[model samples]
Target: MFERFNLSEETLKALRKKGYRKPTPVQEKAVPLLLEGRDLVGQAQTGTGKTAAFGLPAVELVDPSRGEVQVLVLVPTRELAIQVAKEVGELGRERGVKVLALYGGKPVAGQVELLRRLRPQVVVGTPGRIRDLLERGVLDLSKVRFFVLDEADRMLDMGFIDDIEFIHSKTPPRKQTALFSATLPEEIRPVIKRFLRPDHGEVRIEPEKPTAEKVSQTVYRVREEELFDTFLRKLEETPFRKAIVFTQTKVEADELARRLRRAGFRAEAIHGDHSQTRRERVLRDFRRGRIDLLVATDVAARGLDISGVDAVFNYKLPLDAESYVHRIGRTGRAGREGVALSFSSDREDDRLQRVRKVAGDAFRFVNLSDRPVESGGRRPSSGGRFKKTFGGRKGKGTFGRRRSFGNPSGGG
Candidate 1:
């Protein structure tokens, strides 16, 4: 129980109000160390409760009476900045600990006004905006007691290493620090050495599968021209409350969302080209169930914490296995079963092989073209005959004996 951790009454009350009973593995290990004022590095997936693992302790450590920023959290994207701020704010609400979110694309003058008026104790922001504020002599980090870098790998991927270094240079040198990433690539090793203290703690939670276990994955082999038709057919056949369709480019995302809407589906596209206000509005609508389908590119959709996504569709395969895993990870969140469907052509066989290497036995292949559509209806029957294949040896082309498609696991 959280009470065992000796958390503040306010913090415990907040957790209980949020319906959090048991601690996740990352929370169980990291919270205690963080509460001890120890610098640490944590490795875990997106839905593993990393925010609470770090936010809870940070909230406890900050002094509300200081009336200055005592905690600083850096994230990769604007969406993440807003989300982390909301979560941390909720955790610190009862303690009268004010929180603020700063990011680019919003008016700087307004943020400056907020900084002066609110004087939040905790600030969560993107690197660029934080640097801008620091240079303008508004944001004061010298008194910050806790420093956090969430999704460190993504920050580096977006080429924010120099900005991160600049931001860190502004903060006090003796503060407690925490770095969290889903996967620690070789590129991030230097970052770990440069930022974290020599005696920092480390917590890593390894998953049995790279992707969520509750998500059923299927790859459909279709001709390039028939891909959209196949997608429409499969989408109609699948029962979903909400779904996200991923594309490799902004044009594709916009075009796909347009086509989907024309086909009478409630869909909207989000990408880098859209303004920040528009993106936020679209996301708000999606969360409120006004938009059932969200078409997004990988960059725009990173760090999204939306739950109740019943399915994810890869309109086109991502260039690498990591992107594929992240795309499918959007679904199967919060212990709910989800479906991920990918469309690939014979020309993209090599890309499929790379994904298979990481996905292992979870990769299931189905040739939907072989199945006959039902009369007077677009949906195909569950009893329809179709050829099924699973990942296996290079030449074998089969994992185990062929299995019937009628009873696929996780309802896919």
Candidate 2:
């Protein structure tokens, strides 16, 4: 129970109210050390509850009466900054701890006004915005007691190392530091050494599989010209409450969303090219079910945490295995069953093989190019082979060789 962590009653009460019962692996390991004021590094995925892992400690350590920013969290994207700020705000609500989110896209003047007016105890923001604020002398980090770098690898990938370094330099060296990432590569080692204490605590939670266990993955080989038509047919044949279609480029995402809308489907596209207001509006609609299908590129969809996505479609296959896993991971969240469909062309066979190597028995390959397309295709019967493929049941052909995709009884 959270009480075992010996957190304040207010924090514990907030946790209970939020419906968080037991600590996840990351939380169980990192929470205690963070409470002890130890510098730490955690290796975990997006849905592993890492936010609460560090957030609980941050809330407990900050002094609400100080009326100054005591905790600073740096993330890779604007979406993540908002999410972290909201979560941390909730965690600190019982203690009357004020929280603020600062990021680019939104007007910086408003953020500066909030910083001076609210006197927030916790601030979450992107590296660029935080650096910008620091340069403008509006964001005060000298009083920041806790520094957190979330998704360090992604920040490095986005070439935010210099800005991260600048932000880190602004904070006091004695502050408690924590870094979290899904993977720790060599490029991040130097940053870790620079930002963290020499003897920082480390927590690594190895995932059971490269992708979510409840997600059924399938690959369909089709000719390049027929890919979109096959995708439409699949959409007609499958039933999903909500789905996200991933494209390789922002242009592709926009075009696909337009095509889907023309075909009488509720669809919207989100990418970096879109303004921040528009992106948030589209995401809001998607979450409220106003939009049933969302077309997104890899970067735009990164670090997004949306629920009830029952299906994911790869209109264009990602070049790497990691991107493929992340794309399919959009569905099958929180143990809900989901389906991931990918369209591969003849030239993309090599890319498909790489994904297969990473996904193991969880991936099923089927040839849909030979199948005749019918007008207004009917849903596959529950007991039919097509349905069986995604229902965790063994079917003829490729499905027979693999164990049930989502069935826990069928051992990996």
Q: How high is each candidate's TM-score?
A: 0.68, 0.69
Predicted structure with the largest TM-score when compared to the true one: 2
Question: Over the stretch 14-82, how does candidate 2's per-residue lDDT look in tens digits?
Answer: 998899899999999999999999999998878789999999999999999998989999998888998
Give the alpha carbon lDDT tens digit for every residue of 159-211 in model 1.
78999999999999899999999778789999999989999999998644545
Number of backbone clashes in candidate 1: 0
Q: How does candidate 2 score on lDDT?
A: 0.82
Which segments of candidate 1 are over 4 A away from where they belong?
105-107, 207-216, 220-299, 305-311, 315-326, 329-338, 343-363, 366-412
| Span of ten consecutive residues with least summed lDDT in model 1 | 395-404
Residue 23 displacement in candidate 2 (angstroms): 1.2
